[model samples]
Target: HVVDELALLSANIVEVVHDRLSSNVRAGTTGVTLSLETEDQKHMDKLIQHLKEKSIDFKVLT
Candidate 1:
């Protein structure tokens, strides 16, 4: 989620990992996982068409 896109991104971020959890549910890890970087590809194609009109599940490795 990058904390809701970080004021429309001016980032050159690298290797920032995080950890804190409960409710493991056999290690499915129950909710919210994100990694984002934007050096601008037309704002990553309008944030991938606003996450595909809010259907939400996303993956774009480029």
Candidate 2:
């Protein structure tokens, strides 16, 4: 549910370089990755804010 909420929060805000990287991932998978790619610093800032607000653990590599 958190992932879905995150997806919604980031909707239309950033460029998705790739979606669903792994084809073998099954439905209802608990662990998945959400990657956002963009040249704008705002996108990354917003994402970090969202993650903090949600109290979700995250790592950022620039």
Candidate 3:
């Protein structure tokens, strides 16, 4: 459900880069490192804000 929500939030993103090197699954939760690339900075900010609103822990990798 969370992942689907994430997808919806990132619908405007042009591409999503998945960090397979650091992605993994734990006991109950799976960790997914994604870098979203978008032409509009506002869209990026909206996505990040949505993630925060959903209480999803995430780190921006640059």
Candidate 4:
């Protein structure tokens, strides 16, 4: 159950990021980089780990 929730949360986060990237692209923000930086790097790491374990492919844009 926890894994499922994590997956859902990860998917949502990725979707929001992608949407933002799309808008930035449309606004002519060329050569832009996107990264996930947080005070809780461990939490982000864990999220990536969980996604990898579930065979999800996420591109780290930076």
Candidate 5:
């Protein structure tokens, strides 16, 4: 059940990111970079792992 919850959470995060990017584009913001950060690296690790398990590609800039 944890995995399922993670999957849903990850999906929601992706959607929010997508919406932000879309809004930026509509506002003529180009060459914008998006970054995700966590105060605790462990949470970032878990999120990255969940994204990878679902075949999503992401880069950690830290």
Candidate 6:
């Protein structure tokens, strides 16, 4: 459901990856992470706004 919502977002998303940590126990065992990519500032803004509206935790990488 979340992945579908993300894919349907009206932003210039270049890609979307679902990642999980895998440490010694399992690097990404903590939880799944949504890694989104955009091509422009406007797209980034839209993505951020979407995350905010959904009350999702996110951090900018660049």
Number of the top candidate by TM-score? 3
List TM-scores for all candidates, in order: 0.29, 0.48, 0.55, 0.41, 0.43, 0.51
Ordered from best to worst TM-score, the candidate numbers read: 3, 6, 2, 5, 4, 1
Top candidate on lDDT is 3
Residue clash pairs of candidate 5: none
Q: Write the per-residue lDDT of candidate 1 for residues 1-62, one digit (tens) a residue.
A: 54454334454444444444655433644444455677668976777777677676656665
- Model 1 lDDT-worst window of ten: 24-33
Summarize candidate 5's per-residue lDDT along 1-62 as a digit string, tens digits. 43464556553232223343564355654333345444466777777787688775446555
In candidate 4, what are the lDDT values of residues 1-62, reduced to their tens digit? Answer: 43364655553333232343554355644433335443366777777777688775455554
* Residue 28 C-alpha lDDT in model 2: 54
Better of 1 and 3 by lDDT: 3
Please say which candidate is ahead in lDDT: 3 or 5: 3
Colliding residue pairs in candidate 4? none
Whole-model lDDT per candidate:
0.57, 0.59, 0.64, 0.52, 0.52, 0.61
- Measured over all alpha carbons after superposition, the RMSD of each candidate to the real structure, in angstroms, is 9.2, 5.6, 4.0, 8.0, 7.6, 4.2
Question: Whole-model lDDT, candidate 4?
Answer: 0.52
lDDT tens per residue, model 3, 1-62: 55676678655434545443443645555555554565477877887788789897788776
Off by more than 4 A, model 4 = 1-39
TM-score of 2: 0.48
